[model samples]
Target: SGALTRVKTRFYHSGVLSHCVRVLSLSPSRLRGIWASAATLAHLTSSCCVGAEPGSRSEAFHRLFLPSVVDVLLSLAGQLMSRSEAPPLLRTVMDAVGWLLSAHPHLTAQVLSSAHYEQIQMSDDVTRSETHHTTSCLPEDFLSQLNDESALLLLNDAVAQLALSSDAAVGGASIRLMSDSQRSFDVSAGLDSLLEKDWRGRGFEQEVDQLIAMPRPFRLSRRRRRSHS
Candidate 1:
């Protein structure tokens, strides 16, 4: 059943590969989503690229997915100039992509040929250390607050229900609360409590309702330094 195992491994690799791409797409912008996906990407990447049997499985990915990996990461590297600590997963994700790219004799020109190449080239490139001084900043807990998918989902549903409430009085109050809360997300305190109850084991919607009951409940947002900047 090794062949069958390899088939399943390839299938697994394909899905994880897609996840890394999505994270890259959202990076330096969707910092929280980047937060959510970083640990997941690292785990999945280690399993697929580093832990897998080295011969056929690796070769298949190198031939099929490596070029796409290079192109996508080229995009991510380009975007980091403006978003400080924007991607907590940048190192892990890049290691995975870097490992795959290393197997090649040389890097590919696929990015040069891709439509995003020009824009990527023109973007102000940034190093991680240089990212901190750029006037933009991410909340220190950006990764801790969004460490998992269920948490992100709950936050999204919480925002949606608050912003789009159907009850006239409650909707008005919720929107007003959201308007004030949108200035910053202090829900980091509530997140641990929110995530403590297993929405996966119980009802996710039920938990959303519970979260809706909390006063001053807020939407997840990137912090903008509007005061001095």
Candidate 2:
């Protein structure tokens, strides 16, 4: 009776509960009650449409549930990238994405390439700050507004900044995340050089050395002060 009531309640309110449960699932083992609740919610969601005839009901279930599931999964990923650095949770989120990729490759790609995902990756503050400002335009539209040379220069600048970061944790994590995103999206252009072991070796120290070694340009001034007679 209790179990059926729980299932009925979860099934009826699957949308918000799914996300809540998914987030709760990321919690540590000491929170076993929360973990169990998440597991129960997952089971309820999975079983909600069972025994439905192969027709409109099943299709409707998919149409309603799939998007919500994708949203929750992507939200988990964003959380992992922005909020949490716990290795266990990170591994769990990675595994979830990997599994989702196998089952829904296109959807996974869409989620990964979403402007929201990019925003989360670009700045932790955007994720953390409630009042964070973001443009209404799509990431593609924003990028499209940049000319080819501007786009290339922007990309180069981002890469250089990440590669040359003075903080080891920040630089390493940013580069790894970028490389992972590129690999996931099947793009391997500029990342090859970045992924090299010696990349960080050519960071701030090297830039400083080059700057110090370069000679300053001398400019000849044309105007001369008139001599007093």
Best by lDDT: 1
Task: Please give the distance, in angstroms, between residue 2's alpha carbon in candidate 1 and its true position after superposition.
Answer: 11
- What C-alpha lDDT do the candidate models reach, one value each? 0.42, 0.39
Tell me the spans in candidate 2 whose CA falls farther than 4 Å from its real position: 1-55, 61-64, 80-85, 123-229
User: RMSD to native for every prediction?
Assistant: 17.7, 16.1
Candidate 1: count of backbone clashes, pairs at least 3 residues apart or interchain: 0
lDDT of 1 by residue, 1-229 (tens): 5775576466555576556656655645465545435445543543354334435566666666556556665555455434565454444444444344333423323432344434432333334222111111223222243323423332333343333333333323323333322233445454434334422233244444545454543333333334324
Q: Output the worst ten-in-a-row residue range by lDDT, candidate 1.
A: 129-138
Error of 1 at 103 (Å): 2.7
Give model 2's TM-score versus the native structure: 0.35
The residue-level lDDT of candidate 2 at 57 comes to 44
